[model samples]
Target chain A: MSRKYQAQIYVTLRPSVLDPAGVAVASGLKQLGYESVEGVRIGKYIELSLSAESEADAKTQLDRMCDQLLANPVIENYRFEIAELAASV
Target chain B: MSRKYQAQIYVTLRPSVLDPAGVAVASGLKQLGYESVEGVRIGKYIELSLSAESEADAKTQLDRMCDQLLANPVIENYRFEIAELAASV
Candidate 1:
């Protein structure tokens, strides 16, 4: 039987990279009324689905993609999660 | 009075941009046993804390940052939200 999969990847810049957006948002939050916020960092989330014969194969392919295309090793870092979809139950 | 704020920015490549990372994650999920998964797209999330005197000013500055530095207008898009922290509650 064919199998389906889902993956969520989160990407972010290294702390050293300047995050003007993060700073602006933090400032905006202060205007809105959140007084306890300390600092903020921004990142990315990517979700997708695909087919694979086995979990091990899927992980291997995914890791390659992350290293080759998904993330820029020079500045950005990424993490991902994989899960199976329930079969109509 | 001093105020604290938080901002969360979500960034993603335009649909036209190729997302190899997204594809790999989808494939990985399929291998893990998810047979019903469909397509996936990946993006970014950023959270930050800062100080602001008022909401309007904060929004203005945040928008400027998004347009100027946070997001790459050529390929990526970004959105943000700001909220205040309750005092001693």
Candidate 2:
């Protein structure tokens, strides 16, 4: 029998890549009187729920998913966590 | 004097809210041969950099930011962390 697992994957653009959204947020903060505002980078947070034979198996699949479709190797970097799902309330 | 800090904010939909994107992702996973896949939730990962007087000030400001604009209180919940920025490589 397979056990369920969950993870949160965060993908962010590489530092060298230009981020217009970051610039906009910085300006917004400055306008709001957060004078010390510096910068912002927006990224994707994907929550996944899946069933796998083991924790290792879940991570392997997640790594593949991130590399193949979830993240852009040239511009974005991705990281994730894997854990057994707790009983739902 | 001000200190530089960074944080990541994660915002997700309340379970009751209908998530079309989540549904689509779940289906996409199934098609990709991840049959044990159950569900998916898509959220936003916002990385922030700013200057604050102290860690407490940063947390207070982040909380205010989330309440005012970063998240929709009625349908979504948000959380963030506050940390000092280290020297960049």
Give DockQ per model, in order. Answer: 0.33, 0.73
Off by over 4 Å in 1: A1-38, A48-89, B86-89
As a whole number from 0 to 100, the lDDT of residue A87 in candidate 1 is 33
Q: Write the per-residue lDDT of candidate 2 for residues A1-89, one digit (tens) a residue.
A: 77889988999999999999878877877777777667788888999998888889889989887787778989999999878985432
Query: lDDT per residue, candidate 2, B1-89, as tens digits?
Result: 77889988998898899899889877877787778778889998999887787889989988877777778899998999878985332
Largest lDDT belongs to which candidate?
2
Model 1, span A7-56: residue lDDT tens: 77777888788877767756765566555447767676777665666677
Chain B TM-score (each prediction, in order):
0.83, 0.91
Model 2 residue pairs with clashes = none
Query: How high a TM-score does candidate 2 get?
Result: 0.90
What is the lDDT, from 0 to 100, of the residue A22 in candidate 1?
A: 62
lDDT of 1 by residue, B1-89 (tens): 65666666677889899888867766765676555457778787777665666767667667766676567889987778888754321
Q: How high is each candidate's TM-score? A: 0.54, 0.90
Score chain B of candidate 1 by TM-score: 0.83
- Give the chain A TM-score for each candidate: 0.81, 0.90
